[model samples]
Target chain A: MNTDDLIDFLATRVEAVDPGRQDRLLTLAMAGSLCLAALACIFALGVRPDLLRAMGTFDFVLKVGFLAAMVAIAAHGLRRAARAGRASGKLLRLALLPLALVWFAAVMQIVATPATSGMATMFNDWFVCVLAIPLLSVIPLVVLTLVLRETAPTDLHYCGALLGLVAGGIGALAYASFCVNDAPVYVGIWYAAGLAIVTGFGWLTGPRFLKW
Target chain B: MSREPDLEALMRASQSGDAEAHRALLQHVSVRLRSYFRNRLRRSGAGTDDAEDLVQDTLLVLHTKRHTYDGSSPVLAWTYGIARYKLIDHLRLNARALRNVQIDEMDDLADVDRYEAVDTSRELHRALDTLPRHFRLPIEYVKIEGLSIAEAAARIGMTDAAVKIGIHRGMKKLAALLSEARP
Candidate 1:
């Protein structure tokens, strides 16, 4: 058909779009998926018996608190950057702040630990956690990417990494419930490593999966 | 492109499933697409009707993908992004068709490529002439010639870092000048 004629026809045929509705639907899907994932972990892996005791401690609070903060900041940034033409450096920095604090706390713990102290305690579950966090993040990470299919991301790779951070952050929080080791070093090393791996995975997949 | 228009409000209304708002938004985008495609086709030695066909395809894609457009994004960018993908798809289909037709003509095209490259290189040189020597040298060596940073550094008699900075600034200025020169 001719251009003008087609334009006239399209004028009548065009359907109203509801991006806000889609955004709300994405939220519902992600939240429901995370809940299901957490439940699965609890039922299959069993919550750590000392979880209640650990929750009451200051150190434990700080650890989970850092991850919680990551979820908050990353989630906010992900939502913003998911939009077109949104190159929000401020949001990226805001998301990194929580991670930086966690790293800082970990460094301080390393410094304070006696050089003579056995290395076994410090390295406990370090390798295992590096593997575990990414695996745990798979469900939520997939959910996040699926949710993002409805939105436009200008910097696809960065957006994927950001959402990966969100999933990893939330996944770590879920995993924490079953973990007994509350050391700053463990959280710093394992949690950070796990999220890094996921972020890397997102970077590789972002350009391919999130290109649309 | 029409920042003065209340695009956000219009977009929000469309997001609420207001048919009139949706129609208005689509019509607005359709107008922009017409001009965009016409300009692109003119530059690419294609017919204006190709623009219409592509624009129609873009709208269809947009209709299917409307829910993906987050309400907060600039409609222009989002719309253009989808248009770009549609353009790519169209080009790919055309390319495949042309490849079949040109099965025996590929060899002759090599000569055309060389001639075009020479003309392009001369034009590029003219553009580079406007840049300062410090910026131009590094860009020519590292960017155009595809020289390593160390090679560029040695040729320009500058540190690797200085060469990198010069190439960066030179490219940015060249891009600005080139874009300004174009419609």
Candidate 2:
């Protein structure tokens, strides 16, 4: 029970650290969970009736593009956060870039479009967007939580918020095709709000669930 | 042997399952942590026993989190980061426990002279003896002997996680037994 015996106990049971194992597991989990989220969205929510037409629209493309970027950045941040001593400020700033970009685009669109149309665009599917994004994020959030528990995350709240961001981004990406509202302002505000809800939830639960 | 141990190389070898390297790395870290924790705990007006406990706890965490270490980073920095986190967490938990003890002391203030320390110790041992082996061992090693969870697990030949669970359940059972015997 002394430190020597404890060292022997630990050393003898040494499991080789597989190189890139963390990244592989995280990537696989995110991909698989994203697929599941997409399927859930397709089956549960059903695609928009003008699926082909919506795909051709610039707004639809922009919405999907922004969500995809957020997912990629947040996923990268999550990867860094999962490891010990790798949490960095650069990653945080990088993660915020997509939000900044989307918000800027939203502002530009709001300025160019008429006031009445701007209000209509924002409210078109605001309710559905907010409700569905967080609902769909549950799968990825659960998956990420399970994966993260195996890895060491020193900053529980930060890692948790990143988890929620990645999960919600995946959810938004999955729900993008099904949504009828493709306006930049709507996507910017409602998507961010939905993601914020999940992120806040993650931050709150991080200390509780992510405790090693 | 080189004049200075290359921690990075040792850690790299350790990560690849070299037992000697792993042992050496742990011993090196343990020595450093003992002093580090001792100084920090002293600064905070805590005991050397707490320092040893923290050393073992930090070592266990370091072992479990070894896989998360990026090979390129300085191994000592990563180890110390985990140690600092463990120390801070321990302090926070201790603070909360101290607060609870204060509240309990307040409640027991009127009857402070009624319960003797010797009687309480005897009652606690009696309660512990009545519990089953799995539960009893954890409490005995961790609480009575003041061993860290890793040490208790090692002595009991159980996994650390199992030892933790055992202590938790044992404490609950002990509380129930004590409450039942009180009246």
Considering every candidate listed, which one attains the maximal TM-score?
A: 2
In candidate 2, list every pair of residues with a backbone clash: none
The C-alpha stretches of model 1 lying farther than 4 A from their native spots are A13-17, A88-90, B1-5, B37-50, B67-73, B84-183
Query: Which pairs clash inside model 1?
Result: A150-B68
- Each prediction's RMSD over C-alphas, in Å, is 19.9, 7.7
TM-scores of the candidates in the order shown: 0.67, 0.78
**Candidate 2 runs further than 4 Å off:** B1-4, B105-183
- Clashing pairs counted in every model: 1, 0
Candidates' DockQ values?
0.15, 0.27
lDDT of 2 by residue, A164-193 (tens): 888988988888768888877887789889
lDDT of 2 by residue, B46-96 (tens): 666667666767776677667777775687777777777777777775675
Q: Using lDDT as the measure, which candidate wins?
A: 2
**Cα deviation of A119 in candidate 2 (Å)?**
2.6
